[model samples]
Target: MREEDDKMNEHALNPSRMRGRRNVFCWFYSKCLDAAIEKKWKHWNCAKCEQRHNRQAEPEISLQVNHNIAYYEVSVKY
Candidate 1:
């Protein structure tokens, strides 16, 4: 840890770092839980959850790198 831990500091953010660490086989939300659970949706729509939710309601993941660890924690900067 460094002295800066005592205070919030500005840092650049990137998403690529977490992309490599993600489970490629995983879906943001499981298919079984989809609204079409009974219909058995055969194909992924190739959409940003076009069939899932609105743009704003879609979930988001953020990666924060601290000493090479990510998803460790995230915060909003005032």
Candidate 2:
């Protein structure tokens, strides 16, 4: 039990001692989300959402996507 706890603590402290850990998957996902946000914000044409926005002219974009972008922006800074 003591040995196992020591190993776990060592693992936790190693990352802090080193540079840091990067989740490539999450980083890519956030980049894609940022692109989507920029596209929507710029009123650029999106293949999936292009026609939908054009037809309505005034439509509510997904709040969840926007929220995720906001969260990612804050996270990537630090």
Candidate 3:
């Protein structure tokens, strides 16, 4: 009985055991945003060096639309 209690305490104290759900949601959100960005722009160059040139200039509405599409795709898949 003591061993079982100790095991339960160890499991309860372990921080690594508590973060799986949050990590999965964060990963999905990142993937959805990345897909939206890729789909909206064509040049796909580094923003820091490229200075927004050679890219398909889109309005904010278009970006929001693409983001919604990508978010729904991710949500439906998983």
Candidate 4:
């Protein structure tokens, strides 16, 4: 029981070393507006999205790509 607890604690402390280390996924969201008319457009699954999907299954790993900026957001729900 103590060993199990220690393992769990280690995992919680070092998530990057946890089992099944996977690549991190990233996507970009952009907005464009028209000068003449007031309108907003949303583009889903852009090149970045597709690339992220093709990377890997694990989330702890990192991918190599050339891009301007990358951002990640977390979500939690009960």
RMSD of each: 19.6, 21.4, 21.6, 22.0
TM-score of 3: 0.19
What's the candidate order when arranged by decreasing lDDT?
2, 3, 1, 4
Best-matching candidate per lDDT: 2
TM-score of each: 0.23, 0.19, 0.19, 0.16
Candidate 4 residue-wise lDDT at 74: 83
TM-score of 4: 0.16
Compared with the true structure, model 1 gives a TM-score of 0.23
Model 1 lowest lDDT segment of ten: 11-20
Alpha carbon lDDT of residue 46, candidate 1?
23
In terms of lDDT, the poorest run of 10 residues in model 3 is 13-22
User: What is the descending TM-score order?
Assistant: 1, 2, 3, 4
lDDT accuracy of residue 9 in candidate 3:
45
Q: lDDT by residue for model 1 over 6-73, one digit each (tens)?
A: 22123211112111232223333333235234555444332332222223323366444457664467
Which has the greatest TM-score?
1
Give one digit per residue, the lDDT tens place, for model 4 in 36-62: 123222322222222323332345745
| lDDT of all predictions | 0.32, 0.33, 0.32, 0.30
Clashes of each: 0, 0, 0, 4
